[model samples]
Target chain A: MTISTTPVPEPVVADRPPEPVRRPARHARLREWWLGAALVLPALALAVAFKLVPLGRGVATSLESSSGFDGTSFAGADNYVRMFDDPVVRSSFRNALLVVATLPVWVVLPLVLAVLIHQQAPGWKFFRAVYFIPYTVAPIVVGIMFRQILAPDGPINALLRRVGLEPLAIEWLNGRYSALFSLVAVALWSFFGLGVMTYLAGLATIPGETLEAAYLDGAGFWRRLFHVVVPMLRPTVAYWSVLCASGVLIWLFPLIYALTQGGPGDATMLPEYLVFLTTFQFLDRGYGSAIGIALFVFVAVLSIFSVRHMFTEGTRKPR
Target chain B: MNRRTAARLGRYLLTFALVVVAVAAVYPLLFTVVSSLKTQAGFAEDPLGLPAGITLDNYLEAFRRMDMPRLLLNSLITTVGGLVLSVLAALLVAYAVTKLRFRGGKLVFLLIIVTLTIPSQAIIYPLYQTVLDLGMSGEYQGLILAYAAFGLPLGTYQLAGYFQQVPDELIEAARVDGAGHFTILFRLLAPIATPALAALAIFNFVWMWNDLLLPLVIMGGSDSKTLMVGVSLLSGQYDVSVPLVSAGLIVALLPVLVIYLVFQRQLVSGALAGSGK
Candidate 1:
């Protein structure tokens, strides 16, 4: 290889370089700042004004119990103390834990369902769409539909009558043991699509060659899925599980409101519903705000942990 | 048998199972529509079957009792207003995060991500008070703002992904051509991002349209209530009219059903693909 260079002489213009230096005009700088500010301002304003400010107010509100409009009187941390002491509140807490335990079934079933549909077996797209279609419908609509279907003259009763298993068709959402299960069923129906979608994306990243290699090594389907596919999809599983858990807690609003209305003797009164009752129904803004703060802190902590896990795992695998 | 042949057979079976599932999914809708057309006597006689004698009385009763037209209009205004605000604000934030280099860009993005963790219920009470304090309670603007707050994070995340896919060279060329940031965003990026924008719009449209809580609180007055609220109120203890409620639900759900059928693929793709992150 040969390299050649020409020596340059700077005798012509000793004061400056030959190329002109073009500084960004004032308008461009102004525009850059304006654009940047414009982009950051709306979201910032929304977050602070809507989220942060309200959160602060909620904390302050929790200290006061107003009997009339704008007649709040501070009671220190009595609301928090009351929250711990109240039997209904204690039961609500216990009920929430029970619901949380069932969260795993909703989380894992969706992942398993997603994997079932993501497989290259056949008609996967059709199955995927079929499962996902329910997610598009509003929770209100599902609530209304289930209300009818679980009613005495609904299809389930008719089906059971025909099968001579009439006792099996009982009041679903109105019964104590069955109401929570019904709500869970609805949640699974609505959100399993999201899980399926998430898992499909994870499956997309697993190269076909990897699966083929496993098959060639005489590994069976369940063995490959448990050993290879599950390991590769850990990040996705973690992300979805966290997301689904938080979503179950937050998005249970519509389902609870529509189906049970926290009914069958308050068997399904979630924290969100309780917050509503406290604030509006009972006119206890302070206590409602306290519950709101608690719910926010709970969701925030879970999400932070999950997102942290995602990043750590994601970094290790270069995802 | 060959693997291909076996796969083909499996596909057939899977498709058949899907058909059955789809039918099951749509059955409630069919029942609603059918029962709406039936007379009260006919419905009571055969609640699970087709009505022997059909009538539009349920629709008329539902419309008259629920004030369907006004409720529909209220829903439309709130959804449109909420969608416009959410999409614009989200796009602006998304554009900034994806394109501009700034010190707090990542922080702003992280803030949006964290906002998703803050459920609307968490802030409902304070938000209600804030709305009252602003003197905008029971107003469309308050409802729209609430919906926008809920929808902003998802919209920004989705739009950011869409914006990131546009080639850097295209943006660079536009910059060199003396196009300002606004011009590039409105003229160049807007057209390219239309499909994604449409998908987001549809998602927000359904969300805001079908939402029962914010409007239930902010717009609880008779003149201001949304479809969800109206339908819910109609189903209250005094007048537990199943047929009337079903009719109202169908009316409330028709627009969403139409949008879903028309853009099912895009909505599913955007939702699934976005969550893949």
Candidate 2:
């Protein structure tokens, strides 16, 4: 390797790659592997220490009974047995199933709104700005505000009464299933902006000529949404769904804690909240770990789907 | 009616409906702002209407009653520290993952993504235990590392996307020029990835600032709680006093509101950047 012979300075192609040779030396290839491992070591070390170990430890702790972090007895499957038998915990799992069922409403509304905004609907700028505000606001703050708004005689119900529909004004918080639905609605409201933003990004990648061509074929907005826009947007939707499913499992803790307390008969009790309650409130670390493991599995499963395509080189476009 | 006229009318109606939904989205926050200005009596008198009276007392109380300065400082340290840690680490490794194609490049990237699937709740206990074992619990370094660990996947993922744009010639040039990975990353790549770095910083900072659980549990109702967790605890004490709670909510929200106002476009673009694929 003669250092002096190779061109010392090329102004333009200095930043551009010279054509690759068919082969590289073995030592050079070995150096690349060491460099790569060294580069990734910091992030990898942190993940292993903070995330991976705890994940394994959490599973370990779930199998062992603990009284305030000091533990002795190996309670093999007792926590799981207790969790399944306990009616409140059972209902919490059921509530999770119900929440998961609402994934369509969560995904579709934002996709539709994003497409409308992409089409340049009236006041779309204002709509986009307004819609995104909630995403930035802390969930706890939103929870506190919604607690008031959804109080038995709160503004929503107040409006219902004023509109001559008194029968429709059910108890928003304290009723049997009202708080559950209220939780779902608030989650929906806060998160759809995320979907809208993502889909809008997806929409940008799409050539306008595609939509224009569809329009030329006598396709209206509805037809285009299904045939043209949707197929292009599926990847984004998949990513958002996985992100959101994990969110539903874990992110609802603050809102549930602040707004509903998983009350009115465990209707709104998500597994995360159940874990929180078990660990902190009741000092049942064993049971909480069990619930947390279940929630972790659920999230891990959903995340697998999204991460597959999300990081591929094909996703990148040259500037 | 003619077909064209009807289509335009329908479009207008859809726009009108969208506007209504937007109003619904922002109304609670707007209501909190308006309600914060009222006397407790005034708010109770007309919960749905504009305040009949105005005073800055609640805001004053909101500031004075809580340890806002300490909490704010704690928040700044944790969030900014987390942002730097996550970005620097992510940027270093992202360069490798994107450009190095070293042994197990795919495996490394996949491992990072797998971290995303681990529910923070599941790991919260052991993460908490790890911090305690180090005795760094409640300190900025502890919380910052925890936050960085939590945020690494998304940070690395997004930064790597931007990292892919670095031309091979530049990386090769640096290598040929005797620059190691750190030199290549910090002096060379870091400056070029400023836009992505800024986005990651703002995004991570806001997230750490807004998070309540970590501060609440790890900080453990001590002097070290972040501003968000402080406000959460503070509002509980205010209880039924809508004026005070609203005032507190407004206080907690102010910084993010300012950031949003100034960097709205960047934030939106940064958030949506990943979904483009």
Candidate 3:
């Protein structure tokens, strides 16, 4: 409907490579149309049934109230009001903020490493593969592995003891305040490869001649980086930052379920965790849907800037 | 020091840091493998050391306790079936949008791009409700459909990218020959886009395999647990045995690691292609 409907001859449109088979067979054309519809129907049906239906219902379900004893009824904004008033939900949102505040490490750590790899640092090839391996491993597997390693008497603590830094080895995953930090650290460890890959993918697009030109102009490494690479990677950075920003509500679900389980007084209880716990554990479908919607809104609003940048990235003219 | 020497020093320093990070990345999985071979008492005594003795006891115990074969079969069905469904569905839709004369194709693609931004968490409860209503709570058909649906947007988006690369003339020639769209797609275009299909195959397979949430909800407590759910359940049920837990994690990680190791180049190439690299 936007502009595709015009059918004004597109510059990119291919010429008719086939001589028109003028059989005058309207039935064949009808069959072709039917075939297209048939081919598209399965995917469309599943997409509609699972994705579109759930998304449309999420908000409506959020507005309804029900209890185990009492049946369901219409309750406008009651779920939202209850979410705001609850301490655990408040703490979940606050912790989500804390995670968001640590975006620098999430964004920059992989970027710096990728730059080095892109620069062909020694062992960069092996390191690139090594880093991406973490991304391949399931988050649940990572959580289970880290859970034991971060256990009170696990290798981390034992290593600290070996170095005579026993006092530094506090309860890692079990500590209420420390749990969220440790969880973030683990997540960063698990996911930085994705950022590296994304940045490296962006880095691939900048022509070598541009860098050569900069070098001939005596642009130093940092100078070339700031002036050339970062600007070019702006879209890539935006894409990843949005991903990391909104990642709080989605990617951490399995990790929290496996390792922390929102333990020791809800320090690591993310909004997504709240959704799962409320919906499944407490059986509060209405509140869970409401929290899910709120989180969705937060992520949607936060990513608007990045999504714009990404769309522009597709349309951007190479300078 | 001269700039040359400084650069060399910087390279060495960066190499050291890179090694440290790489080791941190690989160590946990390495530790899991090593620990899986250790005695419980040995692990208790020296958790970080090379094992005092090697044994398959933990693996055996974990396999028995976690029901490895059944979990893997269940996971394999979901992954293979899901990937097959996703690829076929995506291939068909991408072909239609890119090649076939279809109204609303542009809007459909746009809807998918917009839908990409809407996280699945927002819709999961209602999705569960729909699934339950259909009486497909723990059925493979339901799980496959869910995985296929969730993986579709990305799958179709990627497939469209590859589909567009096939010169329109080739498809039009086939169309003019009175060849069916199915024949044109599978016979003419698919052979050429094998790399894309394979990449999407591995990509969707790994995703469906590693996915914990969908399986967690749909396949819960129905004698049909996937590997991830099984491993998680193992840890919860057998909290005391660290070695056994490590074994369970290793078993869960093995196939994914193998796929990654074998198909690394394809994965990287696919990522680059998909990301506009």
Q: Which candidate number has the best TM-score?
A: 2
- Give each model a TM-score: 0.87, 0.93, 0.90
- For every prediction, compared with the true complex, DockQ reads 0.32, 0.51, 0.47
| lDDT at B189, model 1 | 75
lDDT, candidates in the order shown: 0.74, 0.79, 0.80
Q: Once superposed on the true structure, which residue ranges of model 2 sit more than 4 Å away at CA?
A: A1-32, A68-70, A215-220, A311-319, B173-183, B271-277
Q: What is the TM-score of chain A alone in each candidate?
A: 0.83, 0.88, 0.83
* Model 1 misplaced regions, further than 4 Å: A1-31, A67-70, A120-125, A205-221, A305-319, B1-24, B165-169, B237-239, B272-277
Q: Lowest lDDT 10-mer window, candidate 2 chain B?
A: B268-277
* Residue A257 CA displacement from its true place in model 2, Å: 1.0
Residues A122-220, candidate 2, lDDT per residue (tens digit)? Answer: 878878877878877888888888887887767898999999999989888787777888899998877788788878877777788885676445566
Tens digits of per-residue lDDT for model 3 on A80-116? 9998899999999999999899998898889888887
Better of 1 and 3 by lDDT: 3
Expressed as tens digits, the lDDT of each residue in B25-107 for candidate 2 is 88888888888898888888988888877888888888888877887889888888888888878887788888875877767
DockQ of 1: 0.32
CA shift at A245, candidate 2, in angstroms? 2.2
